[model samples]
Target chain A: MSEASTPTPQEDERIKETSALRQALIRPELGGIVGTIAVFTFFLLTAFNSGMFNAAGVLNWSTVSAQFMIIAVGACLLMIAGEFDLSVGSMIGFSGMSIALLSVTFSWPVWLAIIVTFAVCIAIGALNGFIVVRTGLPSFIVTLAFLFILRGFTIYLPQTLERKTIIGGVSDVAQGDWLAGLFGGKILGGLFTWMGNAGLIGVFERGTRAGDPVVDGIPMLIVWAIVLVIFGHVLLTKTKFGNWIFAAGGDAQAARYAGVPVNRVKILMFMFTAFCATVFATCQVMEFGSAGADRGLLKEFEAIIAVVIGGALLTGGYGSVLGAALGALIFGVVQQGLFFAGVESSLFRVFLGVILLFAVILNTYIRRLITGER
Target chain B: MTARSTHAPIIQMKDIQKHFGSVIALAGVSVDIFPGECHCLLGDNGAGKSTFIKTMSGVHKPTHGEIIFEGQPMNFEDPRDSIAAGIATVYQDLAMIPLMSVSRNFFMGNEPTKTVAGFPFYDKEYAARVTMEEMSRMGINLRGPDQAVGTLSGGERQTVAIARAVHFGAKVLILDEPTSALGVRQTSNVLATIDKVRKQDIAVVFITHNVRHAMAVGDRFTVLNRGKTLGTAQRGQITPEELQDLMAGGQELATLEGSLGGTV
Candidate 1:
């Protein structure tokens, strides 16, 4: 009794204290955190004098990275719940075209168009989840079907109605619109101007807009990324629902036996993935001032890759949102850093394939350590 | 064990019958489970043991007869309803996620939370402390509450499942082949856990095909053949060999031996 209640150092020899290094190695985010540091260091050493760290250049990559971060957040959570959203890339194009058709061509208010677009996309996501659960089919095949269907609609709709694939003049239609501003507007303009006046930031020397800061303000894209990451991180780590996500992904039958509503948790995750895709679409449309049927092609794979690099196992049930966010950051840095370092941009695909393989190997090692599997 | 019969049974399944279309799984099986005693259900693979327990745990509603739980005829539509009524069944697989931490698995669906600034969050410290304390009470020393459950041995995982059921206020605990997959030492550990739980006055329905395991901890033993009960016996009234013979259908075996022209 004494030995059972009190785990003294002399008692229960099997209870060896895990070494700190071993503990760190067991964390799911270890690979992502390490990769983030390694990528940043590599870029710093190779592209230091190439203007990659300057405000303008920093924004350039940050904007690209933020786009990845938004979608990666959704994919990370869905993957943790033991599902995938192959339709996410197509969902983006479909939603963007919906917004453009409603506001620019159909003469609907931009705010109404944005709200309706989100609603439609979210419903489609829920349908994807519903079919997977009710039919007991793998989400891969189900969403794969939606991927082609939505993309086909995206191209077919514009060609049939507007006689063109790309719809422009959306920015003009969205001017002074409340919902559009949330996606397309910038913030902290006054602070950037003050910094420019104080010589803290570079100013245009002899352009038409001389004496203004080269980088005016932080775009809403970056802000949205930060907000979504914090939200996803908190939702995953600090809530009862978060625990359910892990359990559902780890073992769905076991989770159901434990009284968790596994079906509902999975469906909600699919909807969230669609919602993230829509956010990306809205931001892209507002930034480009146009929507093309070909927009967001293959972005689903990029989001999944970022999530995998963030240390999430492809098998699900284990991951970290902060890790996925850092993974997106690495992608943004490396993609733009190659251009700054005078490397062929096509080699970026090669880097992705190599990094994914490395991350998977590291994740498998971690899984074996956790499960003691051979 | 004699002292436990003085009070009424916590659960009484009277003439429960379950059928799957034309095939009858359980036909009029009755059992009484009392508090503070281990009731062992011994059966072969096709003896309808799984069907009987599923009916008791509300997985399948009995087609005939009724379940009188706590002296009232009750109906359970689903497993969740049975859980709400203080009946918890830990299956052979243990219903545990191998990758989740012990504390997280401990409170998988029913989590305790504390409100912080109008937002509720999972109370980790409370959960961890309770998990460690409850696990120690079962004589299984965990490294820590944060250790993944997959790292534990099979017996330890079974104990964790039992400990979780007890912590959540289970009045009747049903274990489905708790030691079927463990080594000899691990099997003894799970039997000891059953003993500990029975001491706490919780009715433990231990299901097993092993006669030696059942005799070690069972206060009352009920053997099932096909879909019918072969009567029940107290600890000292039945020998292990008789129990084993009853499980394997001794008459049928003897008839087969005779038909094959035994060497004797």
Candidate 2:
């Protein structure tokens, strides 16, 4: 009788334990997850109101994301390696313009033009590396110089390509399938192609007056994104080259002591990042079917944002390839989500800013925790 | 070649002179480090102790005199050459990466690998297995090999570095104040590690300013004062108190002792 009803603190403790078990995760990253959900829901509702879930809407976002994913992968690598390549955005414009001007205006083979363009970009990356290594200059300053110089090149590059004509010619490297397929080409033959890509020709589809024929297979953009992610992850994790990257960023002195040529690694990393930008720029031309001077303007920041969102520490010791992949997806989702929610362009920019700020804070705190624990 | 005798003096430095940028840091210092014996070099701040160790370790190339390692004339341009020559110096700061695992730091640049068609395949499993085996041989019972090195105590970190040198076939291990900053228990642990290392037939050159700690493990003692060796004496030749007197600069010690003025 005494055990059943009176003075039983054990049962009370058990009840208290159950209640405590329901406590929520209050960490900032948890807040990020919650924010992600809230934003996603808000976008879905707007999309429903504005009919953004239509086939056209999907196509639009896919095209935008396809262009972004390739460059974002390289930025992610650089971020994980504890460095930055601010010149990438400029590099793409310059590289693309170089190829287009060479191939279309100069009557050069598309392959040769592409090769020459990439070589120039690689050289620029090496120069950036050499300057960084010799001067111990912060990459931020060096790459920022590239940004302005490249932008200036865009204004004058057309003039150099076609001095006789008053107006410069636009290159068609993007529309060239051979270059596209070589770098990040797509071969799609799947059931999903029934709607996603240009659908089966005349398979009981309405004529132009009655209804538009459905066209679908794989989105070339998705193809580029997938290929880039694979390349980034493998290059970073599975190779000796990747090991060098980790060592170089982790501790330059120790790495050098251990016989890792750190300056060479840095130069290579910059070159690799530039090559990634060129690939991305190539895809942009293919997808858009044209190249211009402002092709890759300010896109470097977007790649950086994706990397930071993906879980890379800025201080050069820890980074993740998968995180960058996920980060790119997150960027896509946010952009589409904003569009679907019927938000104004101004509002979209504001939301992006907020998300970027939150990501920066969370990424920094996690890095601190890791460094402090050790 | 047969290993140096357990009792033979493997490293014998005589009149070692080293200058750094026109500063005569170590001037005419001599010490004999015998296999299987713990030799201590004791001195106060700026007492040429660091310079002596640097000269021995090949960090700073000596200006004059000889460093005989395993009965060979030694001139090491860098620490890597010295390490290869079986003379290992563990710096005070300990160059192990804090974020890396104990096993990774144990092997570090000299990680063991198996060759597959002339290509190196880093046998990670073998490294883990051997890191455990070697560390246990050094009398360290760690929780796990995968544990981050920063988790270990100062003494344990020193032991790990010492154990690495031993496993890599270092005949003469020079510890640069390895236990100076460690707490009492940790320092004792280091002394025990030094003892274990001595049993393995390695000659240890223990550098420190503390007489008590030095006396705790020293087989032969050398004290330096102001860029020169005051004297090098076998432990049996001089009492600890006398050693302490010499290290404290006997003139100041005498003044303090004289104040007691025949009170006894």
Candidate 3:
């Protein structure tokens, strides 16, 4: 029996190699990323004539997306860890509203009320996590109930506001500020402002320069988003808490058997997600200089879509925070590109549907390949 | 029993009965496992083999049974309780995450902690070092501890699961069909590990349907049939044919042999 096709000649290394490669690519999270790029390329080819690649196009849509991209990043971590928080949309409104109501109603200092508002948000987020983990109910149910409860209470809050929002003291964060320069620094150049979508990638990169805006370059909100993403990524990839998140999501029973406090991990993930949502709402409210109830509507689905597009699985076990950031970036591009291209906004829904469908199909195909069931 | 077998039985089951709804999974099943002995439990499908192991591992609240450990009679309420009592079961499928690094999968929930409260901090350097050390102790030479458990052959996963239990204070290890899904080489590798387990003085309850494998490691054999114990035999007391004769229910095999015109 020569090495040439001897019967069952043991080491058929090719089969093993192929299966190994298949396993890495088949992961549900990676599937999402590969799927996103595939669909995005197709859209680019078909819609290229729309000038979505131009600066004004980038300016318009990216500004819109950056708002959600900030929150979607956190939502990705929550989903990948096998939990959900539906109250995030509510958290945004409540956090923004709470900050405004506190400053206007109590005549408290702007900075003091802002700090207190976040503290409260973090606590509430933590509470949601604690309850879900202890009760063993799906986080979706828990957070949804949290949403209805918050919504009912939200109407009562605006009564304390002068214009139901536009509170005193913190207007610079949203509207514009000259006093902002006294402390905000000289590097805060006129065109270098973070408030304007006209900054680089969004605004034609040449024209659309911010004429006059207060809170200036690297608005407190954008700075918070970047910091949160970095921290969230570290929390997910480098710590024991991170591993526990994967284990709990991957196999709850086995995780318990291995001594993981699965409930605790789940609760923390939920709370963290809600906290991010609140921060998002607060930041957006600050940018526009007012807290409105209508803010963050439908953002839950968008955040989930971002996560799925980033390559995180809804079923849990595998995901990446960085991938989520990329996913959010993709959304920013498409949305901005379409707006500046002057394509009908209604057609945007059609694009979303197509991209969503493509992402799922490619993700499933990749997962199947990974399992060797394809 | 040899003079070397004089160590007290690590695990002793007495009249253990388990019922799922109305189905009798285990009926007065009893067995004693001594230190340094690879005690084999042989059964066909639906022979209460799983039920018997579940009872020992605290997965089942036995309707009626007494589990004696270290000579003290007790009952375990959950799998965690069983593990705490130094009892661990390795299922045929090997409960380990395939996508995780071997070091991570090895530690899972019991991750070596750098800080002890309000949060868990992974001791990455410690984990990597200990994982490799543990693998070496189990006679597994690998390229690195960072390799995923899924990449290892089937036999390697089984060995890792067993080593994990032993490393974590498991005095009595229950292996559920560890070699059943494995290839020939893999089966031998597991069998060799069982021998290693015996030399380490940890009593083993090896479940299998293969007679040759049981004969290879077992000093004592138990045959279960239809949720009941048929009989038990020492290695010196029965031939391979005799063991199968008992397992198959001699009368049933005889009738089938006669019906086949002596082909058996």
Q: What is the C-alpha lDDT of each candidate?
A: 0.92, 0.71, 0.73
How good is the docking of model 1, as DockQ? 0.58
Q: What DockQ does candidate 2 score?
A: 0.14
Ranked by TM-score, top first:
1, 2, 3
Q: What DockQ does each candidate score versus the true complex, computed on alpha carbons?
A: 0.58, 0.14, 0.29
Candidate 3 per-residue C-alpha lDDT over A1-374 given as tens digits, one digit per residue, 9 for 90 to 100: 36764432244344544555654665545644664576468557866767555544444444555666678777877786678778888787788778767765676665666678778888888888888777878888988998877765565667544545334345744233333222222344465444354544332234464354422344454456567778877777778788888787777766776767877787677767777887776666555566776566677778887777766767776677776776676677666656555668778778777777776666656544433343
The parts of candidate 1 lying over 4 Å away from their true place are A1-17, B253-264
- Looking at candidate 3 chain B, the ten consecutive residues that score lowest on lDDT are B141-150
Candidate 1: pairs in clash: none
Chain A only: TM-score per candidate: 0.97, 0.79, 0.78
lDDT of 2 at A166: 23
User: Model 3 residue A282 lDDT?
Assistant: 64
| Number of the top-ranking candidate, with lDDT as the measure | 1
- Model 1 in CAPRI terms: which quality? medium
Error of 3 at A203 (Å): 15
